[model samples]
Target: MTQARITIDRDFTVAEVPRRLFGSFVEHMGRCVYSGIYEPGHPEADARGLRQDVLKLVREMGPTVVRYPGGNFVSGYNWEDGVGPVEDRPVRIDGAWHTIETNAFGLHEFVEWSKEAEVEVMEAINLGTRGVDEARALVEYANHPGGTYWSDLRRKNGAATGTQQDPFGIKLWCLGNELDGPWQIGHKTADEYGRLAQESAKAMKLVDDSIELVAVGSSSRQMPTFGTWEHTVLSHTYEEVDYISMHAYYQEHDGDAASFLAEGVDMDAFIDGVIATIDAVKAAGKHSNQVNISFDEWNVWYQRGLDGEDQPHNVAKAGWREAPRVIEDTYSVTDAVVVGSLLHSLLRHGDRVTIANQAQLVNVIAPIRSEAGGPAWRQASFWPFARMSALAKGQIMQLAVDSGKTPTAKFGDVDAVDATATWDEQTGRLALFLANRSMEEGAEVSVDLRGLSASGVRSAEVLTIPEGGDRNSANVLDAQDTVGLKTLQEVGIEDGVLHVKLPALSWSVLELDVERA
Candidate 1:
């Protein structure tokens, strides 16, 4: 077994656990919308045609905020098409995904669904095909109280029911989705996007200054325009937008599991790069308002398989099918462990990366998977997310881990054991999230809980491939429960030190009742 040590101090904290960090994304892509979240004929669907089983599972996953309408789909979307009665709504070709959008479930329906799932809406506007005027109109339609054309139209359209919160009280907004990517609808050069985002944000805020807007950064860290795109966009929209958006999707290529397992190291580097750019722009422009990150799209997607050889440009060729299956990468224990590591990266950078939405919450590379008219089940990746979101509260303690290094092709040398901890003073609880990246050896970890005593373990669960199984082992539709999370038995505390034996290539969450000494 590889040995590792972690020291966590309450005073050396990163920041309060931003509840929005546990957000998820829902796009109008593939089956994510129609058959995934809304299927009227499905036996388990609610009266509103939403899959109750899916909603139940989503609520269990406990996403605090859900970004909606599109990944690429939002670029070409017209806000008006999705309002009023379902029958009256127009059917249009979703140029982003090359699909026929029925407009059956639009803004009103989404807000209703969000209420049912008990998650906040992180709305994204259309800057690709439309611009500032449309964005401002959207703000007025969703937010303004009454008397105005859009607000009165919102009432006439039947969004007057939920929560009595004026303008639906939707606070977070995305200016657009991945505008830097060539594949994006109305793809913009960095200058084009920055100028557009700035003006759009300015106009939307004019409608309702209470809203927080996110400017689009690079679609992926690997994009050729990554650093320059961020710098240019932030340089222009720094004062106007609250956060900058990032989107990334990772997959194991050419059987590079070792490198794939250490993907979080890359994520950390990506966060660092974006932060550096943000700070540089801030320093040069002499601005005080901190521009944070909204990692609105991050997931493990099998892009090669999903997009054939032409990959990024394949969406245009997918034909005009409504809700065609796309990029639904079934996850394995390995994927789940990597996800846990990514979560560790996010928590470690909690001070700046305040909002993160795991892309496509339901069917497309999501933690929870639902079958139309069938069963909805938890994916292997679901356990860590659900557990962390539930148990990690209060402040993110600054955790330092010392461990042996592992060599990988992509990220060079990374720690065999990656970990993060949260200290919740109100509940008298401390939660530790740990991931072992080693493929062959279990990690013996000793955790130093400075100025805190672990009274007892509240819960400890580990997700690992079962004996005789390897990394490729996954939770399929029929065998969903077979590969889920299992209890971690080898855990104990002694003399203010917590000891845990993490299985090779596993994700573990250990929650303990702690008291200040």
Candidate 2:
């Protein structure tokens, strides 16, 4: 077995753990909306037609913020189509996912669901076909009090009822989604998008100056115009916007599990590269206000095997079908491990990358999966996310690792053992999230805790390939226990050292109480 050592100190702090870092996305695509979160007749549905079981799981997952109404769907969406009376709402074709969209669930419905799930709403507007005028109108409709035309429309739409619905007060908004990608419905050049985003941001802020706006960055690091895109966009929209957006999805290709497991290495590089780009613009413009990254869309998605299409596009294909199943990837043990390590990469960069949403939050590449009339259960990737959301508080600590290298085809040789920790001084909680990327052998990992006040292990849990199980095994449909969180009986805190038995291709969480040191 290979061995690794980790050293963490409270003094070596990265940044305060941003609650929005654990955010999620809810888009109008496929079963993600119709049967995904809103099935009026489901056994577990509430008065609002949202699945109570999914809300329960979402609450358990503890996402602090959720972006609404788009992936590429927002690029072609009209805010007016989803508001007012559900009967009067438009039944439009969502070209993004090639599915029918019955606007039964829109801004008000999502705001109501957000209240039930206890999450902040991150709204996105249509800057693709529409521009500054529509963005301004949306801000007025959602945030303005009575007396205005848009606000009156919202009042007529049922948000004026005295149940704390007057002003939705949604603070964070996305100017557009993936405008740089050619697959988008109304793709624009960097200069075009940057100029549009700037004007829209200005108009929206005039309606509600207290709100924060996110300008579009490159869709992903692999884009042909990655660095140049951000530079051009930020050059135009830097001062008007508070944050720039980043989106990425990782997947294993051509049986390259070894390289896929080391996805965090690539993630770290991508984040650092973006930070460099953002700072370059800031330095050139000499902007006083700081603009950080809002990594709004990210998750492990299998885009290759979906259709004959090489990439995810916003083109119409499935005629007109409502609630069609699209890109519903059943995550496995290995996928869960990669997700945990990706969370580690996000946490380690908490200072700059303030807001992150895990792609689509429901049946579309989410942590919690639910069927139309079936049951809702946690996926294999849900455990680490839930555990970290529940326990990771206060500041993210810098971790020093001395570990062996794992050779990979993609990311060169990455550390075999990757980990990150968050320390909360108020609650006396120190939570450690670890991942073992070794595909062949188990690892013996020890964490040096000499600087800590030293408390016994509170709880240790791991998700690994179960006995007589394959690495690709998943908790799908009715059979829920293929690979889930199981207690790690082989962990202990011995004399300022945390010894954990990490099986190959595993993700583990260790939580313990320690006084501030």
Candidate 3:
């Protein structure tokens, strides 16, 4: 077994854990909308037609913020089409996903669902085909409290009646979604997008100055215009926008599991690169208001195996199918480990990357899976995310690790054991999230808690493939325990030292209370 040591001190903290960091996405594509979150006649559905089973799981997962409407779907979406009465709504073709949009679920419906799920809505506007006027109008209709044109219209539409929280109360808004990609409906050059975003942001804030705006960065770090796109866009909209968006998807390719396991290395680099770009622009422009990263879209999507090299653009060639199954990649145990590592990367950078949403909430590469009219179940990726969301709180503690290095095809030399620590000073609780990246051997981790007046462990859990189980094992509706997190009974804390054995290619969470001297 490989051995490693981790040292954490309460005085050395990165930042307070941003509550918005535990966020999820819900786009109007695939089964994510129709049979996913809303199924009017499902046996488990509530009065609002939202799946009660799914809502229960979502609540258990504890996402603080939820981004609404569109991955690519928002680029050409018309906000007016999805408001007012559902019977009066229009049925149009979603050109981005090549799917027919019934417009049954819109802004009002989303707000209703978000209330049930107990999550704040992060709204995204359509800058792909529409612009400043429409964006500003949306803010007026959703936020303003009566007496005006749009707000009065909202009252007439019955959206403000019988609710303590009237006018939607949405604060975070996205200027556009992936506008730099050529595949977008009204894709534009960096200069063009920057000007449009700036104007739209200015107009929207005029209607409601309390709202925070996010400008599009790059669709992916691999984009040809990655750094340049950020620089140019920030040059124009830096003063108007509060955050820049980031979207990324990772997958194991061609039997290269080793490199794929170290996905955090790539994620760290991507975030650092964007930070450098933002700093460069800030220095050049000498702006006062600070800009942070809103990583609104991220997940482990099996893009390569989906169709072809053009998988993301593989919209329904069979013509407009409503709620058709698309890119529903079944996650494995290995994928869950990589996801845990990715979460570590995000938490490690909590100082700047304030808001992050794990792509889609259900049926579209999400942690929770639901079958239409069938039962809902947890996927392999669900355990790590759920545990991290519930256990991690307060401030992120800085961890220094001394470990053996492993050479990979990519990322060169990476530590065999990667871990992150969280210290909640208010509750006197400390949690450690650890990942063992080795494919063949277990890791013995020695945690130094000397600086802390620590008590006994509250709980310790680990997720991995069982003795007879394959790494590809995943949970189904009936067999929910196939690849789930189980308690680690062998962990011990002796003389301020934590000793635990991490199974190969697994993720673990260890928690305990601390008392200050």
Candidate 2 lDDT over residue span 1-517, tens digit each: 8789999876899999999999999998767778878899999998778898888999999999999988799999998988877888889877776767789888888888899999999999998889999999999999999799988878877843223348899999999999999989899999999899998989999999999999998899999999999999999998999999999899999999989999888889999999999999999999999999999988999888556332234234535667766777889999999999999999999999999999778888878788878998889988878888888789999999998878899888889999999988888888999899998878899898756875778888999999999899899887877888889888977877888889889999988878854
Which segments of candidate 1 are over 4 A away from where they belong?
Answer: 159-166, 305-318
Candidate 1 residue 358 C-alpha distance from true site, Å: 0.3
In angstroms, the error of model 2 at 368 is 1.8
Deviation (Å) of 475 in candidate 2: 0.4
TM-score of 3: 0.97
All candidates' TM-scores? 0.97, 0.97, 0.97
Local lDDT at 180 for model 2: 95
Which candidate's TM-score is highest? 3
Worst 10 residues of 1 by lDDT: 158-167
- RMSD (Cα, Å) of model 3: 1.7
lDDT of 1 by residue, 1-517 (tens): 9999999876799899999999999999878888888999899987788899999999999999999987888999998998887778899987776778899888888898999999999999999999989999999989999999989888888843332335687999999989888878899999999999999999999999999999999899989999999999998999999999888888899998989989888899999999999999999999999999999999888777654622334756745677776777788988999898889899899999999999879888888887777888888888888988998899999988899888899888889999999999999999999999999999999998888888988988899988778887887888887677789999998887999998888999999999887
How does candidate 2 fare on TM-score?
A: 0.97
- lDDT leader: 3
Prediction RMSDs, each to the true structure: 1.9, 1.8, 1.7
